[model samples]
Target: MKRYLAYYNENHCENRNYDVVIVGAGIGGLYTSLMLPKNLKIAVLSKKDIYDSDSCMAQGGIAASIQDDNRKLHVEDTINAGCYVNNLEAVNTLVDESEEAIESLIKLGVNFDRDLKGNFYRSFEGNHSIPRILHVNGDSTGKGIMDALIKEVKNAPNIEVIPNVFALDIIEEDNKCNGIVAYYKDKFVYFKSRQCVMASGGIGQLFSKTTNADILTGDGIAMAIRANVELDNMEYIQFHPTAFYSQDFDNKLFLISEAVRGEGAMLRNSSGKRFMKKYDNRMELAPRDIVARAISHEIDKSNSNCVYLDATMYNRDFLKNRFNKIYSECKNNGLQIEKDYIPVIPAEHYFMGGIKVDLYSRTNMTNLYAVGECACTGVHGANRLASNSLIEAVVFGKRAAGDISKRINYDFEDNISTINTRNNPPNKGRQEFDVDFLKLRIDLKKLMDSSVGIIRNIDKLQNALNFVDEVLFKIENLKFNSVLDAEVYNMYLVARSIIESILNTKDSIGSNYVEEYSRHSVV
Candidate 1:
């Protein structure tokens, strides 16, 4: 088989073989590269710039069971917040390895915030029994972690970082993935590897308003579905309830980290009343699903476009010092968070469901692994406890690399054959008439927002299913003029998959709710 790589800097295709091809150069991908065998030939692929990932924009911290925190209590809180449907094995893996992951981050030069007493300054979040979230770079925890990981990855040898490279589809040989078709610069190329890991993150861009970056177009979820991978709990998408709201659509729903509520911030409506108390005993610090549901209900009942997150009620000096990022962003957007009431709304943020993976980050298929937001290890279940996402990414990314290193070495196999491989015929790549997929994607997004989001009823879900089915048919036959077409095609696949998963579910749990059958028992 011939390998191809197209570079815009030089119009030449280079054929090569790598031991492992890791998709999406986010924190997970970066960490995976670092943990791989020192001699392994690894290629890190990305559709755009490497740093433009959902992980890089995370303003919150990583939740863990460090210090004297009780592991049993953390486990119970995670399971409870997951609506008791989380995979026990996956939860155990996360909680058991969390401390090690934190320690690893610290060793990698991630400076988590500490107090004057020289101890880790932890913060509380929704559904946690203890204050164990270790923050870094103040309100820029994601950037801090990503910065450290990226810097280390850049200095590492045997890792080929390929940015602006998009993995369109996986090439399967006899039910096993042999390689992948990647579009780089302006041409499609094939990359064969012994192992592949998908760390491509979530599909937040599908929504009109989200905190995700432009690259999070559901590529990982859509690619797995195309390869017939097992996906679980996709309907349990977590929408952060307190996204900063601005009139400009540029950054309309910037996420106000759950850490704020974890640190005693209040959620109030126009009546100046604390509404979360009416829903859950934990009040403003309840699980994200409960708080988001309450906020959505209030927004609908009051016929308002957004809600309010009152930070002024807290100590202004402390708030300013702690949340400088949020404070400055709000200030730049013409809102004084300390003096003026900051407008907020729920934004479709993280997807809890993805390619189902085991503790080793191995998917059902051979030689294929998934980590980070792209894989549903079942730790998040229906709703993810705040700050657990970052921790999960690093923990599993390390495990995936460790798992792969034990079996594979870093040398290229010269005698590899491609007799079983079949390539799409020339001129079959994408045509000009395939742009209708974009319009169809817009329709799906509107349908998802109106019907499949927040509170769901039988009628609306049925309507959403119908709309998605029609769109999926269009996507199946659609050609592509550009990568946007590819993105739309994948978006349709993910939306349909989420709809199908929702339909198969019999009971209301966490983010997935069907009012008429909410009480239905599967047994």
Candidate 2:
């Protein structure tokens, strides 16, 4: 693997400095920037538009222990969803700071939904014993919180949100992370800083069918792996049980939020018979891993391409108001959600394992933090519970900021800012072989979907690994013209990480499943 995907001569490059550099502009990075001291100069480098992160696409609400000592139950439910292999301390912190996280968002102008009495309406989702998921604008929870965060971030004088900057590698000198190398504005720029955080979202683009934004390319996790940072559970990828079955969208699949089922939707097989009972007792309300596996099995048993989500019991008014986005999407596709059986299929959703971090969201490397989907803090263990991702970003993002507050030495900022100052604009490095990246990316996604997808076997995993290695071998010496060249390598690294982790794990658990009788025993 190439340690640095960039070809930069630091002696003559467009170099800039900051007190802290965040490699993503998602909710985690934005919240971290907001929580940090106002005096610090922070730069949030985004791969695309500032608001293009997956956080804005989230439809379900953030989960928190709003009711009485539901904190204990929340922790229990989270652990249960992950099959009890979660880090006990990390889970405790996530639960303990639940209320504080929600309060922080509210104070920052995030308006969650509440009833006439002003009590927050807690919706139910799989794995939770009771209703605790908080939403805004019915189904636009991600956009709601992101709009508020973007406003706050823009107003904060110390934070700079730079779009169109694709972070290629974590820059380390003498075993300490000090900055990042990225492709920005058609040239390589070095962003040097005292501290750096990698919040660069999920690895969904590796699969052909995913409920993640296309911008999510696993850049953070890939760079961390190359840097030898400790990664905990790289194999625990969560596949959502219900994504709208359609081919109209781009590479991204439209997610059917778990909140739909939480509000009384039912799952049916191709024969239009409710089929979840044969798989689990909780039926539509089971944990995400259970539900996804159940759907996969049903699809196989019926030899059908999709199953049905029966939400026909609700009135049109209720459906429109409660699930306005979903209702409209279904209608546009010729299915009225209020009276039609919506076609659904399981799709790649979330990643539970990534660069390992402590309770404070600090990775193994000093002065480097990995927050959000990129950091495997172990709260989710084998699989993540519904709506916990949004809460995790803020709860731990605040902690990361708090930890940095005490550790940041203001005296060192002056010298590090101008350490390597020989100022000249960077040259576009040698453009080598231009491989067919478009075709390569398409094939890679299809390979991952077929081999490393929801259901897996030892032979398929090994074959997939070999295929990834072959692709990497082909591109190992190729030169780059666009960020896509570097992104494909990152994608392959993430796929290899997931597949290797699965091969090492002998037992089937959570979302990482292997064929029951195909050389690996199912747990």
Candidate 3:
């Protein structure tokens, strides 16, 4: 890896080389970078600043089985929530390693909330049988964890943090990933590395309304597809049960944390009547797929755009203390947590599938790994239990680091010879931003929201696939000069992949509800 770096720097006009290249500065990428051997050079790339990621926007806590012998229960809950389609081995790996992951975070200076007795304060979330979801600063869990990890990453001498770098594609030779081709600092740069990890979060931006950050345009998934990497279960998009409905057409939606529901909030219809009992006995505490589907059904029956989450029944002081971030956000939006009924609706929240990987988080392509939301290890299966995402990221991130460290010195001369290299040269002439491209992107989002959203059927899936095919062809002919152009192209690829996956899947399970299979019972 060091030799490749020197060769690239001397032969091609490039910045530098690294032993490992991690795309995305979120929790998974940062954790993996921190876990790697300190002697090896690593580069962490971010599309924007480090803080601009879905990981930092997460408000829910991280789940773990803290009690002795409770790992069985945790695994059971996860598999049950996934409709029994979860990979048992991968789920066990996640649950078994969760304690160590939390300890690693704490050792890295993460200040999780604790009680007077010095035990960690764990909160409950939807589908969690116990109060094992660890948080920090109340509802500001993601921000707290991100701040600590960013600090540690900056202090690590061996890791190079590069911001505003958009990875366009992975450079492959002989079925091995060598590095990435990225646009950075107004030039196309080739970053050579022996191992490449794709932790670039989800594909939520493909929808019209989502809780994901604007930068998540599915670049990692698209690049992987172009490289012929295997993908799985793209149809299982989790719609968060309660995103604050602002009635505005925007991608960024304020998430009303499931912690609020866990604390006894009621899901009420427009007539001020509780309705979740009609769907499931667990009510608001049910898993996300059930809650989201129930909420959607309620909205359809009442002919309303949204429902209400009534948390006012709780003590005012308790509400404020437990969810200060949510309280402040609601107040800023002209609603009071203790007085007004929060208008909420389901929105695209989590992607349970991406480049398929194994127990070690290694993709089929050699020298390549994927962790976080971009990798489908089959732990999530058809639906992700609440708060499992963060823990999965941390656990697999560490696993990927450990596996790479064991083979960092392995000879790759034969693999290097089998690679077919392609160069993406920097743009010479300045290309003006095209308004038509912006309109096309908007149209694509609307199409996904209407045809490929929460509820689907064969006809709808086919229509979505057709639209994606047409738009993708047009996108291939367009030239890119700005990050938005590349992002739009990636969005097209992501949308097509998702639609294709949905069309191939014939059953309704978990978050993916196809009308034809609606009568078939799940699990």
Candidate 4:
């Protein structure tokens, strides 16, 4: 793994120092930076734009225990959805602070939808006993939250948002993290900081069909793995039950939010026969794992590529207003939500496993933290409950910011000006980059989708592991020059690790692969 590290010279590198270096610019990173004391210099690096994050793609809104909702129910629902494998302390922390997380977002000018009475227009989603999911502008909660946060980030004096900077590795010395090795304009940019945060989203792009952004290639996760950070539940990958099915598998699939079914949509086979009754008594509102498996079963039995989401019971005007994003997407594809059943199939949607972290979002390593989808904070166990990802991001982000603040003056800042660690700097590795990354990525996605999709057997897992070995062998001599090359390597590392974790898990079941508690670490 050391042979594959990002290269740099102690003398030729351009060193940029900050009080704190955040490796991602998603909701978690942005909120963490904004929450930090304004007197501190903060730098937020984005692989693409700050807007390009899984947090920014969330449409179903954040979950919180407000009003009639109780923290007990929220925690239970989360634990239940996670197959009771969640860390009790982390679950309690998320639910106990859920309201505060929502309030913080609102205070930051996130205009959640409200009725004329000035009350929150809360909605329903899969697996929840009540309508606690809050949205903004009907179906654009993610963009809405990101818009407000981006505006706030722009307005903040001490926070610097650096776009198009790809974080390559974590810089550490004597088992303590120092900063990040990043790539900008084809040069090594060493970010010297007292603390570092990995809010760099999830490992979604490793699949053929996912709802994640193109830039989400698990860079942070790979970096953590390279740094020997303890990872948890890596086998528990959550596939959403409703991504709009498409023939063109190259692009990021459009996700049909679970809120659609929460709003009374029914699942039907291609023959127009309702199918949920055969899978679960809950029908259209089962947990994502159950629903995705049911859909896969139906697809297998019917010999079709997709099932239908029948939202026609609602009038066009109502659907247009409530799910305008989905409605417009269907319309663009020559389908009508009011007149036709929208074609949907389960796709790789979210990663439940990530860099293991405590309630404070601190990883096993010192002065390092991870939040958002990339952090396995024990909130979402084997399977995530709907609408929890966004709230979980901000809640843990706030905690990480507070913890960093407490430890800021606690740790000494970089002594010398230029990223000059007292220890010897990392040297460049010799390699080749003569292959086509585009083709490698496409083929890798195909293998992951086929082997580790909604259904998996031990045979498939072994084959996938073999494929990972083959890919690694082929790229063993490849040079890490371009961002695409870096991302491909990250994807390969994450893919291999996830497959290995799955294979390592005893008595594993279908898509909702659970692990033995022996693999988890609690702080």
Model 3 ranges with Cα > 4 A deviation: 1-15, 410-435, 520-523
> What is the lDDT for 282 in model 4?
82
lDDT comparison, 1 vs 3, better candidate? 3
Q: Write the per-residue lDDT of candidate 1 for residues 268-368, one digit (tens) a residue.
A: 88666778877889988888878888888888778887788887866667777899899888888887777777788888888999999999899888888
What digit string (tens of lDDT, one per residue) describes model 4 on residues 319-387?
A: 999999999999999998899989998888888899999889999999899988899997888889999
Top candidate (lDDT): 2
Local accuracy of candidate 3 as per-residue lDDT tens digits, 244-265: 9987757779899999998889
Q: State residue 77's C-alpha deviation in candidate 3, in Å.
A: 0.5
- RMSD of candidates 1 onward, in order: 3.8, 3.0, 4.1, 3.7
Quick one: ranking by TM-score, best first? Answer: 2, 4, 3, 1
Location of the lowest summed lDDT over 10 successive residues in candidate 1: 1-10
Against the true structure, candidate 4 has what lDDT? 0.84
Q: What TM-score would every model get versus the actual structure?
A: 0.93, 0.95, 0.93, 0.94
Residue 56, candidate 2: Cα error in Å is 0.5
lDDT of each: 0.80, 0.86, 0.85, 0.84
Candidate 2 residue lDDT tens string, 1-523: 5654334554344678888999899899999999999999999999999888789989988999975746888999999999899999989999888998999899999999999999998899998898999999999999999999999999999999999998877777556887887878777787988899889999999988899999888988889977788888988999999999986768798989999999989999999999888777888989888888788888887899899999989999999999899888888889888778989999999999988999889988988998999888999988899999999999889999999999987887444443232232233443376689889899989998898887787898899999988988887656666788789888988888888888998777787777853343322
Q: In lDDT terms, how accurate is model 1?
A: 0.80
Winner on lDDT (1 vs 4): 4
